[model samples]
Target chain A: MVLAAESQLRLDANWIDYLLVAFYFAFVLGIGIMARRSVSSSIDFFLSGRSLPAWVTGLAFISANLGAVEITGMSANGADYGYPTFHYFWVGAVPAMLFLGIVMMPFYYGSKVRSVPEFMNRRFGPTAHLVNAISFAVAQLLIAGINLYLLASIVEILLGWPLWVSLIVAAAVVLTYTALGGLSAAIYNEVLQFFIIVAALLPLTLVGLHKVGGWDGFTDKVAQGPGGEEQLSSWPGTALAGFDSELLSVIGIVFGLGFVLSFGYWTTNFVEVQRAMASSSMSAAQRSPIIGAFPKMFVPFIVIVPGMIAAISVQEIVEFKETGQGSVEYNQSILYLMRDLLPNGMLGLAIAGLLASFMAGMAANISAFNTVFSYDLWQTYVVKEREDDYYTGVGRVATVAATVIAIGTATFAASYSNVMDYLQTLFGFFNAPLFATFILGMFWKRMTPTAGWTGLVAGTAAAVTVWVLSEDVTGTIAIGGQGGAFVAAGAAFVVDVLVSVLVTVVTAPKPESELRGLVWSLTPRKDFHDPDEQELAWYQKPTILAGIALVMVVGLNVLFA
Target chain B: MAERKHEAGAFDIRVFIGSLLGIYGVILLLTGLFGTSDADLAKSDGLNVNLWTGIALLVSAALFVVWSRLRPVVVPDDPDEG
Candidate 1:
């Protein structure tokens, strides 16, 4: 708990602070309520009538991608890693855009499908769809809960309020906005919140930077800490750094993280895809990803700067090594910096920004959760009578159900670990398996439904086995560490694919007509055309330009290194 | 499949590069000029405000250069529209 001065801020946490928070929530809810009139059908409710302008969709796209956990987590990582972590955004996500735009987007957008799972069904089968959908939904729930839990915990820490009170209050605000708005409401609020987040963070960073001697002083200070010089300056020293990994691995991570991740995200992640479905045209949907990419490029600045500053401010860190207190918790660095540096009003603004960050993440998860549940699960299974009104109304109910589940799960998440770690672990668990399924389904023609489904279930099971076995087993035998889960899940996916492919070949091929319908979604194309013509068109000069860009970026980085 | 023809004439590569140069050039220059002296830049007192501001300038300049060079293509509006 904060001592007197911080405690006083909470006691004196006037109606004005409440009013500011309330107004933000109200604005989000207002957009949703207003949009409700336009949502006369399931597509309209889930997607927003497919009439969003490019800029609006773009802003929302970025907003949804950023959540409170991202803000807090990035800030924490920056504090630990210094400027190299920023490369994760630039080096990590940018090339991804190129790959996604040039390679994956053509196929995904070509599909004209509502969900990634639906596409899986086309390529693989119903089994693949069911496995992907369930895993995705489970992952979404875990992530949403973690995001909300973190938001609440951060608010309490800043305000010196009770944790449960903070959790309930924050949950209520997010639920109100999301419940009222759906995707349209969430995206609009995200844009508004994005600005607020930037405004709050930029000034606070300046102040924190000022408190430190600036960037050089900050880096120098961090350089002096135990192993600080080596640790602060270098990359993750893992395969992800692209140094030790094979060329294929490096290319794969870059392509997988950037292109595959983005394509998969935009195409599959219900939260983001809802924006595309809601857009006014096919072009608008395409533009949304491009628009969203702008902020993604800059997001590192928001999360990384404070963490870097905190590293410099180590003297004030009250090193818990002596007191059993400050043992370098990765996520708390940003919040700690704010508490130590900012005065009252600035602190309040920072808290608000933090909440905004958390809400953005939670809001995306919630919005997407409603989508998957409504479109894939509820509409498909429960309702044979699926009218537009019926599905739309069911979407609202699912939104509520999602919110309630998130709140309950978040309480448990907060009790165990900080929001960022919990989120990353969960993300790795779900994303690793699903990523393999989608990648194979898109690229390989022979990937049967049995293969897709087997890959998903087996991949998840492998990840779980690692999770379980890691506790008792010694080094090589156990997979119970940070990087282990990804390795496990990834291995499982490969195994599943191998088994499923064997089964598929041994069985029989589906009819050409059935294959034709799916070929559009699975293969690359400008429109629903023959796969052969599409493949030919995909070649030509664009590949040359893309190849040039890749060489230039790598060549420049290598030369500079 | 819809075929897109790339008309090099339609691109403004020069302007893009020019803008990138102007922005990043300013950032690089500012940090180099106004950022902290090399003596204090290495010390652990705190953020060398001048240094960070300088680095920020350098980064912004680099970003500008990259952005300008890779001009985003805008689709031409249909002339056949009634």
Candidate 2:
């Protein structure tokens, strides 16, 4: 059985392939070296001195979200769940990204806040800042660690490389660039990675299409295969019919993943928002995510289609079934496609793209971790009155420390059965409540500092309780996997809102003068309109572009359905 | 502020990386198209993923270059100043 599986999935490469991979590494390292001189201060280190244009920041913003695990897992999910997997990108991502660009960027970019936790401090108080900053810092570390572990696993699987070597090399590369040049290095490399990933996947999609004939032929082949037709449907009847009874219903997707998780992640997660916040101007900041949305909407084609193709083509599933392994290794779907479908030179380039994405993801998390640690924690607590250079040094040190911690965490993560599932559960535990705090703090003038902290704590508690009870004991609660997370997050959001409203009604609110630029009602809106934007044609406007993206998303949903 | 001004005029790294990839990608693509044997093609399940990917990489690189040229990075005066 093992031999059959091994032969079914090829894992051989030659010297020329290694040469191509070496070139890719050299180019990435060169970018980092070139960017080092630009990091003279803390601002440049953390926010790229807020000087990048929309396109640079935009691609980075989207790319920062695209980790190796995300790319591989999405493809795996495509194989497992079919077209419905796109719910993650479309319903789960696009709207929230648009919301961040239109509604949230003004507050984040306009207030000149250094970090999201600082924004929490300004809006709520010191206690709220401490809670948020600590949570965010820890979350980024875990995420970075998991990304490291995932990359190492991919290398081990594909190249027969030892796990430790992959982890060390990835850690070293990420640490060198992020610690040296900071966020600029991270963002620039993300843009380059974005191109590489797209380039790598485009061919896979085309080859898969040509092999299966065309879109119609592809769909027909999948439908003719075992459980293929059902998988091809983007909307599997009603929400209840589509998901497992224990997982999300239609209502759960709309409210839980869409409203709570999506909004929580896209709008508030500092790792993603930092990219948009690095834009040169308010207009650029707003336009950044909008530009990102265009590419984001089409990403399913690159990541998901290949997985769908694998579902029909790969025979590993049958062998696994015959062997009674009791599990289909769906996560290896993309690897199977690569080994069977890509030529020698192309295989090397694809592997390089995979490596680039892993680095880009790790660099993004490390940059965010260092910034939060230095700005929100170290500067706030350890040394309050520090020079600019002192903080910059601290940030660099934090990068190294974070990478070490991540390496350790990656080792720990190796014990988990499924890293992707573990991550979703973690996000539910943290971000759901974090979003609750942000929603109330931003929109509600009557919400007090105590209320903000209380809501966050209570929301996290609710999510954890639900998750624990569901996974360990009764299994009655819908909280084991991603769907369970959505339900738990939704429940947490409700609990948070109830607690916040209850606390706020009794507690005293911050003074209106102090609340300026922090709360929605009290904050005066600044006109973000640029004359340059006006100079462009109407269709080129950010609003118009966002509108078009929304229409396309809807069109895709309908077409797939 | 002076440092900021000097940085604006510094080499656009996006274009540099794009051009580098574009050039190399074109080379790999040409090689994939013209140099491969039937056995080599058979190894890839009869699909020329290399040529297709090379073309895609070149296009992406061109897009990056064009985007950088169209809207060069503009340094905000005293961006760090309150």
Candidate 3:
């Protein structure tokens, strides 16, 4: 989060580049202007009226997270930890996404639930739903603020404007498109942003590779870099995990990151899920995440490779990392490479990409924030049985309100220059517990609502306790190599399971009849995927698509290793 | 199979995305052929990156345009899904 604003690009774009950026923005606003016609109902405003095809929703799904924060953060990880950063994508994200599409989307899309919290209400009852909705709403706002801060900082660097001025300008762009066409505008722009991001970054990676001679030369330089041979392998990622034993490090990456945190974010978070939820059909809904997995897996080549190249080639970063100069931060690896490698015309496209990404991320956050606020919070609690058009009006107003609140949040994010570690630890405390409750409640019909209530509160408390014990909060103990957050995640998962199991034994579970489609064992086999309803090709099936994604990701891991 | 959404002709996302890419590709391709300098090529280590990438973009743009043209988006008759 902090990294988004940490390192300014020092752009040397010429008139041609500026012209290119102008063209890009014109397209962005044009999409919004056109999409506004499609906005006729609350469903249109909130979920694109549930009409987008699998590919559009799919690209939007990845584009939402393919923000500047992710690009910069993952690149920094590559520069600092080298090949091990691959674990974040391959080990952490792909499996969880597959699980969602194959196992979870049936329950999510088959039912009339439009949001994750709405689904929670049907399963665990109202109490758990309120907690999930409120926490999720608050989380998106804070994250949007962070995205806004990053966007404003980039705009400030580009135009030489003041921070507040840049902040409003940045906020206004997102607000306009979002307010105009609603999710349709945002999702269409996201799909375009996805292509622009790839167009901009792929060349940088290729050019940087050529500068280092080739793939072999790049690997050799990494092996000889600060982290030594460990920097070249994906396994035994001791440097990345902050674990002493190799086994512990692998466990941290697989379980803490892969199972708990990944599932927490991808399957449960409304921002990513909202994209899939907008799909045209149940089959399309499931394919959204699976389609995204293909592009998601290969993104590291363009993002991380540039960072790795920067670590070895860029003098400022090399000195800053080898010493504590702070001359050039590791997170600025992409920016520095853009400066050293790209010329005027290409430079502008990359700059446009950075802007596109920041807006895409904030749009995702703002759009999701408005959805959860309107559907789960306001409509559920305050107002009932209102006309559908009134809620569309409410959603539009929420979009504006979220943008305004996000500006305030962005100010908060800007003030805390180096608090990202602590904020991430705090996030783990929120996410890990929710995932625990969700997975437990979904699988075991015996898990009671009383258990859900206790387990969520207890799990979060346990995670916070671990954070306080670790150096991330108090300087009493030293937890290194990003291990503290992993430990906190692990603690949350374990405590939630322990508490839920205990409470379930004492309390009465929901009746079997009521838990039919929501619980795994209770759902009929045909309910998972209704082959009788649609005559689909073998290639169109979610299982075949997801299976191919899994195999390709594993192949990438092996090839890179 | 997923039920198809009726994207009104002018508002098809693929058409817009294709048009945007076509515009960029034409601009880049023109600049690569006419405006590219020796110094610019030297920066990217002797490859005419603009020219190559422009051609790639143009090819992709053609594909997107042809895709939408070949099989246009079909909207359901009663588009009242909420």
Candidate 4:
């Protein structure tokens, strides 16, 4: 009631706040300029010259994925749905990251492929490679556009700036640095952005918790609200029991999100893996995602807890919950809290962090886009004998083109109410069945190139059909929202696996000699670690670190449950 | 090889960024602790979010600095060894 009576929230940014944000932008651009000299070759531009240590690459790896959506949307989910949102991190991300580090990094890193599509080229031949490259390039462009739209909207709301102003400013800053420095620049800024984000959000959480009288008081207050105990409990009920209006079955969350989507994104998505591949050594490459897992586990506190706080503290959020009216302005949850809580200079730092996150996300997508376009598409199809500088030039040109395309896409994405949800649905269509192709291709020497193409095409078709059908279809079989996405992805994965196996059996397999280092069974059994890594303490070992991360993930699940 | 080592030890951006944040964080933390008026406290719901947040940022900066110190980039003798 008190919250309802209160007027609309407005950001009270002072000169200090503006100064802090300006400093952040200046620092990021400075880092880009500083990193420019390091990127002499296409390899350096695309892969950080493959020289960064695990820690740098590791933080950047996670930060690449921590876009504006992760900060804003996850918290919005927290305010609306509560603890189940943590599943995105714990089940949906951590295990898959560990899988990438321990099992799959050998193929990705050991084989010396520049991009994910390049890896497909080696395993599945030219057709599959082309298909993957085109789809990924298109997807990255859409994502960049959506991120631009979301960030512009947030900036407009928070700073009372026009949408076009934020869009151009963001695009200009991102394009200047990204084109100049390449992946190394993008990565360095991502690491910097990560720190800025942690710096910004940690205080918001602490202050929020303090305001609501700590965790117990916050929980009690949320329990008294509209959603009640369901919102507080991480495991709200059985798999069949619905949370609010959404049907999130255990099968859907575990199989669909945890298995298909997570594996597809973490293991195959070049944007995330490019960071790991940039590591200085094979050992560092293996350890990078593992190192990332530690911080990835704790991200929910900064992103999600703020939303939980707003659920009880803000009336607009409560009213949205009660009326079930026009879609919950869940995306505004973080900005709302900052406006309500942080002081002038601190508010600037927080906004800078938010801006940093948006830029990092866009930069990651753009850099990946450029690399995939240059290496996978241009090198393979356009001209094979061009100088390295020529490819690098193409990469720069692609970066500029990609940014323009993303800006155009952002204009289109403006029509979408929930950009984050729309993006996830888009990912479900593209990335869900990709894991099946990757998994079967890597593990099964029997899997043919034709099978790979067939599986991918058929799997994507299955996912798309389900999504389309879900709109008109209803009743026991009807899949909708996140649950629908999970089911659709699961179905696609199953279809992909079955089709690949069947096709592989029917068609002749690639020779074992040719498959060496590309397929798991045919590849040599070389140790993943270097001599120096072998000498490190047990806790420092990649396997040990990943194990620890897994245990921590399990512990968090139990604690939250 | 010597050039590589020099590159490794060269101005680490992480450390530079960390040090900057640490310095700024200290300033903000001190301001939050000592310079806050009653009106400022009222605006923030009686909790010094800035003070707490600044402390957290400082700690984060310290962690980044320490991580860089402990695992200073190691360039292999053979550039291809990685």
Highest DockQ scorer: 4
Inter-residue clash pairs, candidate 2 = A239-A250
Each model's backbone clash number: 34, 1, 1, 1
Candidate order by TM-score, highest to lowest? 3, 4, 2, 1
Per-residue lDDT tens digits for candidate 2, residues A483-506, read 666767887899999999999999
lDDT of 4 by residue, A1-561 (tens): 212212245678777677778777777767666566544432233333355656777888899999966887688778877887888888889999999999999888878887788889889999888888988999999999978877776666666666777787768877876766555466667787888888888878877888888988998988888877877666633322232333456666777778888888889998888778767667788899999999999999899899889877866677777786633477677887887777776788888888889877888888888888988899889989888999988988898899989989988777654455566666777787788899889988888999988898888889877767773245345555566567678778999889998888889877787777788877767734465766877866889899989999999999887
Ordering by DockQ: 4, 3, 2, 1
Model 3 TM-score is 0.92
Model 2, stretches more than 4 Å misplaced? A1-10, A38-52, A237-248, A318-328, A388-390, A472-479, A527-540, B1-10, B33-35, B59-82
Per-residue C-alpha lDDT of model 3 across residues A1-561, encoded as one tens digit per residue: 443344444676788788788988898877776555445432233343355567778888888888855677788888888898888788877877888898889888877587889888888888888888888888888888888887887777667777888889999988875665456577778888999899899989998899888998998888777788888889988888788889998898888878887778789888888778767777888999999998899888888889899998887877766775654556568888887878777778888899889888888888888788888888989897799999988988988888999999888876543323434565677888999998999899999988987898899899888888886558466675477888888899999999999999999888899887799899887776766435887767899999999999999999877
| Better candidate by TM-score, 2 or 3 | 3
What's the lDDT for all of these models? 0.56, 0.75, 0.80, 0.77
Please give the range of 10 consecutive residues that has the lowest summed lDDT in model 2 chain A: A1-10
Question: How big is the positional error of residue A459 in model 4, measured in Å on the Cα after superposition?
Answer: 0.7
Give the TM-score of chain B in candidate 2: 0.74
Give residue A7's lDDT in candidate 3 (0 to 100).
40
- Model 1 is docked with a DockQ of 0.04
Ranking by lDDT: 3, 4, 2, 1
Docking class of 3: acceptable
DockQ of 3: 0.42
Better of 2 and 3 by lDDT: 3
